[model samples]
Structures are given as structure tokens and as C-alpha cells.
Target: MAKVNYPEEFAGFAITDTKDWNKPKYITYKPKTFGENDIDIEIECCGLCGSDIMTAKGGDHGWGSITLPQVVGHEIIGKVVKIGSKVTLHKLGDRVGLGAQAFACLNCNRCHNGNEQYCANGVTTYDGKYPDGYISQGGYASHVRAHEYMCFPIPEKLQSIHAASLCCAGLTVFSPLKRYIPKNLPNNEIPKVAIVGLGGLGHLAVQFCKALGADAYVFSRTDSKKAQSFELGAKGFIATGIDGWEKEYFDQFDLILNCAIGLSGLNIDAFLSILKVEGRFCSVGLPAADEKYNVSPFTFFGNGSCLCSSALGSREEAVELFNLAAENNIVPWVETIPISEEGCETALTRAWDGDVRYRFVFTEFDKAFGTGSA
Candidate 1:
């Protein structure tokens, strides 16, 4: 007897890190079968997050041992082919997007309060935990399987390639921007926001902050991204090395989103010096879990400030972000790559070296979208 092939059980990339890029052979994966609760996505694209590099190595930064040879991606955008029997949140053939944390224990306090990403124990789409001890996979391949709650419908106006970075980088920054906006300042005054990195997450933060009505600023170690910053809606750009830059914007930011993955040589005092009194400095850039940092003890006491961090976002937030992007026409700046291209290793290398313009979104739409082997 032959078991029927469910639509969600599409063949896709099964990646297994071969350790040596010179002899590159990746194990692309295909689900053995599909379940009713599973939704299959035609993985149109996936972004290259900094976390992906740290995760692939499985080192001391503190995510513990990553599932080697595992498909590595989470910033994903795609189209759906099927939904489960019990699923009511989504339907067949929806343009949807998914992010880092996939599912959570709904009974937990955080999950119940619309912060499922903070659920004490939850399943991340990749390099994370689940009930069955099965290591979750990611969107690096041609297709992906996820629960209905973890997905958001894509805005009709969004370009799928650009929408890919919005999942992780977009959501990570989105949660903080929404929280930092002053409640009484009227909708128009979204505040002056500064983003500390012009990489994968920082670029998206620029677009998001601009879309939210904030005066956006970009801070980079070098002035290389000034042109891109303007194109992405940044109202201002600051090169970190300018001798008097600190004095100019001191106390100017109501909110500062730090997207710096590593804090080495980071002028913590200098970065904090720009915040207004009672301002919040929120960080979304994480270096695995073992990375360490020193908070400015005196700055907090004197400036009346606090520091915080966020873990992705909730299912409801996903819906809101989806509609927001749709309504306002926010566009993410990204570089596209075909999933079957031989240069994937090269792209991963460049991403590791921090050479990618903003992000690398793997277009897994090959074969399925009138393209072949790619």
C-alpha cells in the first residue's frame, strides 16, 4: 500500500555541512511525509542572518551544540500549498512569511500574553528545541513545514525577495520600534531612532523605523553605506569615527536599537551617550548565548535609562507586521541568490566576512517557478 504524498511534503534542500567548502557537497533535505497540522511552503527566498554563521559552527558563543549538517535559515518568505485539518488561521495558497521562533507552549504566561517568542520553552524554526526532541529545520531549502500559528500572510504588494529579510531582521527590530514609540506623542511623532549596524538587521531597522514615522539615523564604523542609508529612508547617517559626532546627537534619540552582533572594541559609553534622559536602549543582535558585555553602570544611574532585549515576536505581531508592510508599502533591501547555485558556499563565505550589501535571500523558487535545478 502506497501512502499518499501530502502537499506539504514537497522535496527540498537537505543541507549537511561538509566542513570543507573546497569539497562542497551539501545534503539537501526532503520531509519523509507530511502531517495534517503541517503547512508546506514553496520557499521563494530566505535571508542570510548573522546568527546563521554562529549557528553553523556550533562553538562557545552559547547556543550549545548546533545540529550539524542541518538546513540553516529562518528569515523566510514563501507561498503556501496546504493547511492542516484543524488550522483556521490560514488557508490554501496564501502568500506567507515565517521567522525564528516557530511554536511555543501556549499555556505559558508569555505565550498567553502575546509574547510566545518569550515562552520559557519553545521551538525555534532552526537550531532550537521541540517536544519530540526533533531538531527544527530552517528555510534554506526549497520548501519548509511549519504550524499555522507561526506563519503570516504576505502583503500583496510586497516583493517576495525583499520580504525575506523582514521575517527575522524585520521582526526583531519591529518589536522594539513599536514598544519605544511614545504613547502620548500622537501617531505622527514616532521619534528619532538610531540604529547601530548597517548589516542584515540594521538595514531592515532603517526601513522599519522610517515606516513608523521616526527620524532614522545610521551609525556605522565606516561611511561605506551612506548612499544606501539614504535610499532606505534614513534621514541621517553618522560615521562613528567623527570626533564631534557624539556631541551633535547627544540625548537626541528617544530609542536606540543596537544590532551589533559582537561587542568587541565597542565604545559602550559613546553609544549610550546619544540617548535622551529616560531613553531605552534595546538590543536585538545576539551573539549566540555566551557572548558577554559590560553595561554602563553610571550612565544608567545618571541618565535615568534602562537596557533591554527581545526574542523575535509573537504570532499576532506577525499578522500586524504583515498588514503594516502591505498597507504602507515597506520594502526590504536584499540580495537574491538561487538555492541551487554552485556559489552558495561563496555567498556563505561573504556573509561570514560581512561583505554582503545588506542581506542574501536564497530564492528556492527554482524548478517550481519555471526555473530548473536552481
Candidate 2:
């Protein structure tokens, strides 16, 4: 193993107050004490997830009240600078990525059954606490410490910038499509899958749907994203803003994956209307706590469609997702920004305004933190 000096304190751009959360200030903080199953990572790049911005905003527009001096980022890609004695999944100097989740009880039935992401005792990568009362920080930093099980080895074929978003956005959408789409369909019997929204998660969902042998369709508010959706392997595009738009496609889709955020205006009845009987409408987007769908018990009476949501994927699914990306050459549409106060503000503001083409990844870590990149 390569010998490298680990830092006593990790530094990151943090939200000191909800008033100015988007305007993060560079600060140094202590991480939890190293444990037998933990590994220290030297962050190279971290993706800008919607959750990061929402958590920063707090109050009505955000997740909830967050711990002060919180560093919010979860799609983390870094190099293992140090590994614990019991760590076998990763090693010193190995490149890996950590997503929204940081830890889970490995002894649970859910963990054993490939649903560890839903483990009742699971911990998130940021704004989460350990049993020892140590607040977990995220990667917008020079270094982060996490349990080895939460880290996945990056494939050689994928670039760090492209692989960063896969840690969260990619995994979020991938898990649902992978679960609902059948793999044993005959070559001519391609399943028609609808991916709502054309942002970070939706774009990737289209690609994964195609990669999984399904005919991908994109459902957006307008036709503006039509061409781009097709470029991302979507076979069709549905402009849901038009009146009675769901009429033509009624009972046509095998599955509808709602990747749209801020579901306050979403037409649940219309979306569920298109699904074939017994079809699934799975959502992976996280809107504000108050933004909810007004679905009644009668919502599923027409088609018998099942409405559900998926969390971040499991460790086994993460491994499969990376391998699938590598084999299919799947790359997220990402814009790289240097990690700095000004840069973070620019990225978060644009993302909140829906100005980004797809995803934003923070790079130039060495310049920001004075720690050499791996």
C-alpha cells in the first residue's frame, strides 16, 4: 500500500446559515474517529445533486432544518488514501465513489436480500449521524471517511467526471428501471418505458432503459427537450403539457418512471392513465416535503397500475450499474466547475433555476484545498 499522510481535519465549503446557504464558505471540520471498517478518501470530484441544493435552502424549499456548518454533497468520487485493517472491498490508492448513503447495518435481512439501501438503520452520506454522535460530512471536501462497504470501485473505462454523478443520480434512476423492466423478453417484444422529466436523472434513465432492452420514451412539459431526449436513446417523446396528451398513449406504456422533481403540478391521473393494466409508475425524484401528489384511492382503479418509489441502489446494484455503464459507454451530460465558494454559488443557483444542461460536477480539488489530486 502507498503511504500518504492523512489530514487531521477535512476542509469543505459549508452552509453556516440557512439565510446564506447557497453561498458556502470554506471551512475545516473534524471527521469521526477512524474505525476498523472505515476508509479515508481524498476527494477528486463531487457531483451537484438536487438534494445538495434543497438541503442547503432549508425551510419550505429544502429538506428540513440542517445541522449548522453542514457540508452537503453526496455524489462523491475520490481515491482511498487510507484503509482500515478490516477493509477488503477497497485498498490504498484505489479509486472509488460514494453515493447518498454512507452506512447500513449489514446484519439485517434487507441488507442480505440486496435491499440494503432501505435498511432501517441506514445512514446518509451527508447531514447524518453515527451511533457515536459524530455528524457525517460529505465530499465537497479534501477528504472524507466512510465505511468500506459504501464505496464502489470505479471502472477503468469511465472517467472521474462522468462517473461522479453515477454515485447518486445514476444509481437512483438505474435501480427502478432495472427492477421493473424484465430482462427475459423476446427480442421483438421490447417493453415501452416512459421517463418523465429530462434533467439529470431523467436523461440517464432513458439511457438505462434502452440499455436494458426496453424502448425508452421521454415525457416532458414541452417539446423543447425532444431532440435531446432522442439523442439519449429515447425512442419517443411525450409533451404532457398539451390538453388530453395522454389520450393517444392511454394504456400503451408497460412502465412509467416519474423522474420529474417538484411534483406539485404533476398530473398523476394522466400519468397513470397511460400505463398498461398492472403496469408500474415508479418515481425516483425527491421534491420538497410539502410538494406531494394528490392521489386518491381511486387513482389506480382504472388501470390497476402500481404507484411506487425507489431509493438509492444497493451495493450489488451499484457494481452492476458501473459495469453496465462501462459496457454500454453510458456517460452523463455533465458540466465541470472548480470547487470554490464562487463556483459553488454559480452551480447551485443555476441548478435551482433549471439552467444546467444536465449535471454539474465540482473538480480542481487540489487547487481548492491544496491537496494533490490522485
Candidate 3:
């Protein structure tokens, strides 16, 4: 094993100011104190997520104001270099991945019930504070120290770059599909699932829905992503930008997973009209705080549908997602950029401009951080 100095101050590209968030500066800062249940990972790569940009831009965008000099990449894949005395889940040299969450009060009912992602006192991977007053940093750095439970073993068949985004985007969609879609219907009936939008989350949602025995479909404003959606196992594509697009699919879906970043001009009634009676319209994509679905009691009066949203998934769901991905060869559409200040800026800028086909994953961490093992 190559020796890591494990510097007291970790280096990363940080958002020093909300006004210029895209221009993250390379800087070194102290991480939260390592604890009995904590493990240190030498970052191999990290995935760029919409939440990272939202957090970088600050409160007005709805993700809330972040502490200055925050390192903000949560979809992290790395090798464990250090483990706490109480850590039994992982050992040195194990490749692992962590998503949006870093810590949760393990004693909580939610945690005990396999819903740790919803723990009220949960701490996010970045822009979060530990109980001892240390601000948690993220994987846009040489190393990340997280609780053992938050770290998941990466499947051998899943490449680090490919597995990185699965930490967040894949889990976000997988959790909802696993919860709403049942396995093995009495007549081998496959659930009909519609993924709204065809971006990072939606693309993964389509693959997972198909992997889980659902007949997945894509709903996008235009035909731009229609062909790719079919390639990703989508059974059908609906060009929602067209007038009267919802007429033919009335009450046809079992679930509609909304993965659009914003609900700004969405036709809620039209979407609801496509769901079967008691079907669900679940939003996993979080838009700006001010962007909301204009729905009321009458909105669901037609088919008695339910409107809901899912949080980032739990550890169990993450493990299941990785295993399922390995078995089904579920690969996300990703573009890679080496980790650097310039790379961070470009990734954030293009993602904000809706220029990425799917996700951006940072690579070449050893070249940037000199933390590669022998």
C-alpha cells in the first residue's frame, strides 16, 4: 500500500463566495475530527450533482446558504485509508462510495426502520456541521472522513467513475422505484412507470425501472432525448411539449417519477390524468424553493392520484442499487473531467446551463492530490 500522510488540512476546490460559486478556488482546510466510528477515504473520484450547484449558489436558490470555503461534491468514490477502532463495515484499501448523507443519529426510529436517510438529525456530506462544531467537507478533496455506515462497498464490476454518480442520482431514483413498484405480480404484470425528464436522475430512473421489472417510459418536453431514452430501456416516449399530449395516456400509469429540476411550467393536471386511479406522482428532483407544483384538492379529483416526493435513499437501498446495477449492467451516461479548479468551474457552469447529456464525474484524483496508492 502506498503511504498517505493524511494531512491535518485537506485540499479541495471550494466555493469561497456565492456570487462566484462556479469559480471554486483550490484551497486546504481542516476536516471534521475523526471519531470512533469514522473512516478516512482517499478520494478516487467524485460525481457532480445538481445539489452541489444549488448549495454553491446559496439560500436564494433554496438549498440554503453554505459556509464559505465549502467543498461540495457528495457523490464520492474512494479507497479507505484509515478506519476508526469501532468501524467494522470497512477496512483499509476497500473501495467505497458515499452519497448526499454523511451522518445520522443511529438510535432514531427512522434509522432503525431502514429509513436513515430521513433521520431528522442527519448531516449531509457537505455543508453540514458535526455535533462538535466542525463543518463537514466533501469529496472535491484528497480525503473525506465519514461515519462507517454512510460508506458502501463498491461492486467490483462497477467502475469508480460509473459508480460515483450512482451514489446520488442512482439511489435517488432507485429508492422510489423499489418502494412503489412491487416485485412479482400475480400474473407477472409489469408496473408501468413514467420518468419525467431525461437528465441525470431520470435517465437512471429509466434503467432502474426496467431492471426492477417495470415497463419504463420517458416524458420530456421535446424529442431531443427520445432516442436515448429508448436506448436506456424506456418502453415509450411522450413529447409533452406537444399540445394534448396527455389525452392518449389517460389513467395508464402505475407511477410517474418526476425527475425534472423544476416544476415551473409543468402541467400537473395533465400528468395526473395519465396515472391510474390511486397511482402516484413522485418527485425526486428538487427544484428551487420557490418553484412548486400548483396543485389543489381538485387537481387529483379526476383519478384520485397522489402527489409526493422522495428524499435521498437509505444505506440498504444504496447497496441494493449497486448490486442491481452490477447484475443488470446499469451504466449511467457520464462525461469525465480531471479534478482541478478549472474542471470544477467548467462542470458547474455547463451543468447549470443544461449542457451535459447526463452527469459529470471528476477523475484523475491521484494526479491532482498525489494520494494514489501503490
Candidate 4:
């Protein structure tokens, strides 16, 4: 790739130091070189994700090391401001969203095989290295640049704020549910699908499971989310804190998607026991580093269940997720904060502390950074 001209400046809410996240500073940055297949989106709203908080807190998040002065928000909903000459997938003025991925070498086997999330040269939305030596920045800004293939056009029925969370949190669970959950099971005997934890990802998982025509059940530690879970179309709610909860639901689930973030106090064995023979269990949440799940060979072999992990889904899967959301009227429960230096900081801090009801979306980018290229 050839070096391209760098823009004079672009404004974004950024944290200069990894250790100090008291507040983000509104500052200008030199954006990555524009590519022919890239589209520059003027952000409307960006959702606060757990990964963003984890990155800001400073640690190596499996994929790579954290970089300083990072603009961190990947669940982005925006309007297309500029499109590269060769970009034909989307046009200027299109409403779209970019998820955890920003770019992937399309020539790679993974990219060509409809598994772009596993691309060897995958570039994340933030904390990533670009081909032109520019560090990949994220959507907590006035504008964001991403390959056309990574951008999915938001459906008209889906509002920008609501579409924001689907970019990452929704896709993280939706992809695995689509891949693992049984589709042809009878209505009476439809496989029971359990969502572990009722946080951002799990809450949306419940809605998606119902939309996909499965029996959606929430497995939470407390009964706090029981009423809300049922209201969100869940078939039932299982509070693990209740005595003999595991025994009550033993061997009941055909597929279990664990959306819980940490494994420090998780009863992995109890979760595994709920799955019937040949059941599938997949985790999409970013657990703490060094938090291990230990399973005995007998426990593993006797149940004949499969365990795995999922990351963000492909761009095509993202489009399908948005379509499903629109068709089913599925909207995430989000608290909106105006997009400003202080607003960004507040959202991040609350999200870090796990205080948000479900998700937080930062809006009003035009007022925050002005209505220009930046």
C-alpha cells in the first residue's frame, strides 16, 4: 500500500493515558490514509461496549496490545460523509454501522469463505494497525473510516441509537445463535435456548432467540431481570441463586450461549449440566485474562456437548441481524448520553462499573465536533 496524504485534523474524544480515564479530552487526530475501497462515516451515535472499557483500562485483550490515545467505540451508527472512488457497495448519505471489525484482507481464505471475522490479517475497529502504518482509531469521534465491506447499511426501520448496539453486542450473540441453534425443531419440542447473564449481550440474545423462533430462557444470578426478561419475550427465567435451580432445569437446553463476562465466581459445571446430550455451548463475552474453565474428561465425554467461543460476525451476518431486528421490532434497552467530552467520559465510567441497565449510546456528534469533515 502506498502512503497517502494525511488530513490536517479530525476531532474525537480521546484518552491520552491508559491509566487515567477520569475524562476524555476533545482533541484533533491525524486519521489513517484513505483507501480506494474505504468509506468515511460521520458518526451519529456510538455504543459503549465492554471491550472498549477493557481496552481503556489498559491490558492486552487477546487480539493485541492496547495503544495509547485511542478513540474507543466500535458499535458505530453513522451517515456516510465520503466514499472512495472505488467504493460501490455504499453511496454517500447512506446510514450504516461498523462493528468490531474495520478491515480484512479480502484475498485471505477466511474472508473469501464467508468467515471474515477469522481473517488472518483482520483489522479491528480500534487498537489496530493499518496497512499504511497508521493506528486504527474508533468511532468515539466525528468521523470514522472503514472498508466498504465492513460497513452494513442500517435498515430504515432501525433507528441509529437502536442499531448501535447490534453492531457489536448484538452480532456477538446473534452469529452463534444462528449457527448453533436448531432451526427445524418442532414448535412443541423446539430446542430450549438459554442466555447466561442478563447484561448487554444476554438481554439482546433473548430477543434474538425469540425472533429466531426458539424458546428463549434467561439464566441469571438474581431474579431482578426475571420480569423484564419475560417482558422481552423470554419463555422463562432461571435464577441460579435460587436453591436447586440447576436440578430443576437439568438437561433441558439444546444450546446455551454464555454471555457472562467474568468466570471468577461462575459455576461452569452447573451450566454444562443444563445442556442435554450433544448440546452446544458457545461463549462470546470477553472473560478476564487467566480465568480458566476446567472440565473433567468424564464430564466432557459423558454429556457429549461441544464448547467453543465466538467473536464478531461477518458483515453479511451483521446485515441479517439488522434485518431480523427490524422485522421483529427488536430494540435494545439503551440509555443515551449526548456526545461531548464529558458525556463520553460519563458513559465510559458508568459502563466500566457495570452500572448501565443494558447499554449506553453516545449521540449528537454534530454538536460535539461540529458538522464538517472532522
Candidate 5:
């Protein structure tokens, strides 16, 4: 029997089994029909995130609600190919990007107040349920359909591959950092900022802090990334594996962006112990295991430090980060892989092994899926 094809079908890669890494197969799936307020983008590049890891390796610890045979690349960059009747935000041939989110209930308070990322009725780019009862797919495909509101215009100065990662990784760190910085402070007033990991998010955080006139520091397990950290504008490097590493920097940082992937061997109390009075420990990393960090109540009260977390950023924040990157000539350190079945498999395996420098972006989607109509 011939498989039934929907009116709107796009080619993409998906994994059917979580236990098998070699199981990602190219497939065609139907997207939601174009609405008056929507636009369709022919994807140019898509960056793989740690969240993709969690989504692909499904289990109790991973994203639990993901439907099978999911297309899971959220950090997307492309050119708008088609726009609906009422889509005023973008037109045909406009360069655009979509982050981790697809749509939000515009009537919600959070959406109306410019915090749409927290909208209770929000839909994610992938593994999400849309209002029209269609499962949301992501940018790891030749074309992506999205509501116009979630589509951000990519800056002319920002490269597509870089913009793809920034749609999520850059915004994740930029949102909280921008919110925390005091507006009255002078540009020269160096706030002490520490980035907890040297991977995708932390690398971008270092650049953002430096561009925002803060003294950036990197806390890592070894000196392997020390040179790269300094090159990326870090003021200092602290290897936590070294004995008494936190003693010298006691009450040092104004804020710590905790971007580490896991809490394994991380002394949360000790990290919090070094915060200045009223300092913040903000986390953006999603752990793969059900793990808890040991922190005493006194740890919070003693240093007057607070803990907070941020997820995929709001549209406003994404724009702000994009503008900041454009102004500062900020670019993420990424390794681009040409889009192919074998290449994607290797990229996923490398990401799983924690081997990439920072980010893995898949490019040449048009060639991968045959030429897309733009």
C-alpha cells in the first residue's frame, strides 16, 4: 500500500529508537497548514543543542512527553519562502530564525507582557502539541513552518550558522544577564561575572559579559580550555579540580552563570560560598539525571546569594541578543558539518561523547533535501 501524503510535507531526519544511535533516518512528515499569520522558511542551517541530546535519548530523565519519530533541531536559521495573507512581520526572501519555541497564546499575561517564553499555552518548535492538533516539528529539515511572531529577523552582520546557535544558546545566557545588570551603572563599572562551563552556553556567556563591560571568568574542570577562554574575553580561569581553588576567590563574583551540564562532582555549596553578598547563581544547563546538589539553608542566608534558572528565551530577548551580537561583532565558536545522513550521525555521536569545541551546526540543507523553493 502506498503511504498517504499530506498537502504540506517536508523532508527531515528523525530517530525512531532511543537506544540505537544509528537509527536516525530521513523521513517525510506533514506540517500544520499555512495560516494567515504564519510564514514558511527554507532552512539553511540548524544547530544541535544539549536539549537535542535529551530529546533523542528518551527515558524518564529525558524529555518525557516527546512523540516518537520526532524532528528535533530547534536552533534554526533560514530564509522566509512563503508568508500568509496577514503576515506583516516578514515577507518572501527575508532571512529569519526560530528558537526553541514556535507559538504562544497571545492572550496570556506572560505573552502580553513580553515574557512569552513562559506562556502557559506555549508550543515548542519540536516535540510540542500545537493548537491545531498537529505535533510541532523543528528546523532539522528543508523547510519549517512557524507563526510569524516567533520568527526573528536575522541581522545582516550575523552569519547564518552563528545565528542558528544564538537563537537559543546566546539568548539563554543573555536574557538573565541583561535582566540582572543595573541600568544606572556606568559601562566601565566592571561587575564580576563567572561562567561555569566552557561549552556552548558558557562560551557565549563569557563573550556577553565582556561585551557588557564586565570582568568575565571561567570555571572549569581543567586548563584545557583556558587559552580559548581568554581568547573569548575571559579575565581569569579557575580549575575547580585544583585544591582550594575557591578559597582565593571567596565572595568574589557578583553573579555566576552555572552552565555546567551536570552536578557530578560539583560542590554547589563551595561555588555558592564564593558569591558576593546578594550574588546570584543562575543555571541554564539541563541535567540528564535526577540529581540534587547539597546546599545548606545557611549557604543561601550566609552569603545572601540566590538561585535562579532560565529556559529558552523570549522573542524580545532574542532580538536584544541579536542586536548585541551585531553591535559587538560577537560570534559563537562552532564547527559546521555539511548536512548528510552520515554527517548527522557523526555529529550526534560526537556531541554525546562531549567532543565538540562548542556547537555543531548542520548546513547545506537545500542540497541535503534537494533544492528548496524560495
Candidate 6:
């Protein structure tokens, strides 16, 4: 909790216009009077997620009209330098992090039950408006002022650079694994897990599943990521583009996590065929514009299985995720960039081109003169 009053103005990134969703012009934000439940953090790092790009150009959000000229960062890790009068869960100088969520309708049953992400009227940390119409910026700039209710203290055991990316991407996979997988399977049957795609979320999924004792496997269109996947402790790798490969691992995995993007030509029949009886197929991939699949009913019924979907997990689950990562020594494969990179068009163009090894992060903030990077 920061005791002193904050500067009337602070530095942050804002997308004030809906131009190219990728190349957002940087802007500054001056915060309101320090609220009793709000704490200000000096950001250390933020991971560039796929949604940041989507929000910039706009997408089929269940809600109407995508908010633009909105700062588009969410995966944030930083240290609290100020605390509100009523905040006790965290204190001043404590290392902490915030995810895609900024505020939620706590009065709703979802928030009351700890599933804040599902709240219908939730305010995203970036490019969203609270019920009061305050547009929430993200971690692309130097400092973040958010309600303490939406933040968590990252444990000291984890390093800040690594900790920055996990608040969201790390939590994205951890949530479902804890919720979907059996609570306590025997060591031998820890559940054979297969991760599709090897990007930001996919890579973390591999680490989370591997550290959780699953015989983790990686599936890519090609074998290019084979060595890196194994280095992350993957037990096996398969290239789906190769012919006659599906027969080798048919009915093998207990849980198949699809992390790849775009659904065109997706071999639904093939991927499902690899699942054991009563196995599950889950997805976190955001398909390209107007993407769809052609799956027959047999895909689920034939295997005595079903499909499940999840967003990021609860606040409690996020903490548990950090604990698990610390205990298991799991770390994400990441590439850091200065916030000056101009996120929307330039940053996202590179991302879409597969220019990033795994994840791209933004760092270094300056308050007086907008973002130091751009």
C-alpha cells in the first residue's frame, strides 16, 4: 500500500483512435484522487497477448462496439509503491502483478464465486470501460493505477521479468488444468497431456502440464519446435502434417489442449481420434476472422467424450499457479521489447508473421513525457 499521494499525472499508453488496431499511438494518462481500494504500481514488464491485437482492430465481442483509442496491455508484473487507505492484502513496496482483468461486477454471482472473468459486465484491464465509464489502460507504460481488488502480490521466489508474463498467459492454462483434470490421479496416471501450438499460451501450457506431472506432448504442423519442446520437458513431439502419423498415437491422450490459431482445414476427426475413451478436447485459440470448423456429432459421441472451454482462472487460482510454478521451477520462453515498439501494427505485424520465438513483452516506463519507448 502506497501511503503518499500520487502525481496528478502519470505515463501510460492509450489508443485514442481506431486506426490500424496494431499501431496504436502512445498517449499519457493522469489518474484520479487515490481511492481507498486502489493501489499504484511502477510496472516492470507486460506480455503482449493475442487479444491486444484483436481489441485494436475490434472483434466479435459479445458486447457491442469495441472500445478503441484504448491502451491494450494486460499481462502485467510490477511493484507497488503506493497503497490506498483500505488495502491490506498488499502493502507498499510489495512485488505484484495484474492480469487481463481490471475490474468486475463483484455483486454478480460469478464474481462472488471467484469467476470474475465470466462476469458479464467486467472491465478488461485494457481497452475496456468500467461500469462508471473509466477506460482502463494496460501495462505498456511505466505505472499502473488499479483497484487493489484486481491485483495480486507475486511471491519473491519468482523473478519479475519472468513473473510479468505469467499473470495472464500462465494463468490461462493453469485454470483449466486445475478445473478440468481430476483432482488427484495416481502418479502413474497423472494424465497424458498434449499441447497444440508452441506460442505464448501453448508454451506455458507445456510448462504447466509438464510441471504438473503429465506426460506432456507437443503437436506442431512441422517439427521445427521439436528440440525446444523437449528442452521444456515435453515427453514427445508429433508433426501432424506428416502422413500416417495419427495411427501411432490414436487413443493416447487424456486431454488435448488446442492452442493453435485459425480453424481452416483443421483435422477435427484426426485430433479427436487420438483421445482415449472419455477424454476431453479443449481450446484457447482465437480463430482468424470468420473462422469455423466442420465437425460431425460423432466427434464427441464416438469417444464417450466432451469438449470444455475456459478463460483465465480465478484470483485464488492465479496465486496457486504462481506457487506451482515456483515449486516446479517452470519458466516461460520469452522475448522482451521496449514499450516504444508501437504495439498495434508494428508489434502485431511481427507477431502474426511468427517473428517472435514465443512471447513478446513490453518494458521500461517514464512518467513525465509519455512512454519512454515511443
165-202, model 4: which lDDT tens digit per residue? 99999999999998888867655687789999988999
Give the per-residue lDDT digits (tens) of candidate 5, residues 180-285. 7544545556788889999999999999997777888999999999999999999999999987888899988888999998888788888888888888999898
**Error of model 4, residue 226, in angstroms:** 0.7
Q: 1 or 3: which has the higher TM-score?
A: 3
- For model 1, the superposed segments whose C-alpha errors exceed 4 Å read 1-25, 28-36, 60-63, 186-190, 288-290, 368-374
lDDT of each: 0.73, 0.90, 0.91, 0.85, 0.85, 0.75
Residue lDDT tens for model 6, 212-241:
767779999898999999888888999889
| TM of each candidate vs. truth | 0.88, 0.97, 0.97, 0.94, 0.94, 0.89
- Which segments of model 5 are wrong by more than 4 Å? 1-7, 185-188
- C-alpha displacement of 153 in model 3, angstroms? 0.6
**What alpha-carbon RMSD in Å does predicted model 1 have with respect to the real structure?**
3.8
What are the clash counts of all predictions, listed in order?
A: 9, 0, 0, 0, 0, 14
CA displacement after TM-score superposition, residue 97 of candidate 6 (Å): 0.5
Worst 10 residues of 4 by lDDT: 1-10
**Model 2 off-target regions past 4 Å?**
1-6, 185-188
- The CA root-mean-square deviation of candidate 3, after full C-alpha superposition on the true structure, stands at 2.0
lDDT of 3 at 38: 92
Candidate 6 accuracy as TM-score: 0.89
- What are the root-mean-square deviations of the candidates from the true structure over C-alphas? 3.8, 2.6, 2.0, 3.6, 2.5, 4.0
- How accurate locally is residue 104 in candidate 6, as Cα lDDT from 0 to 100? 71
Tens-digit lDDT string for candidate 3 (229-273): 999999999999988999999978999999998888689899999
* Model 2: worst 10 consecutive residues (lDDT sum): 1-10
Pick the winner on lDDT between candidates 2 and 4. 2
lDDT of 4: 0.85
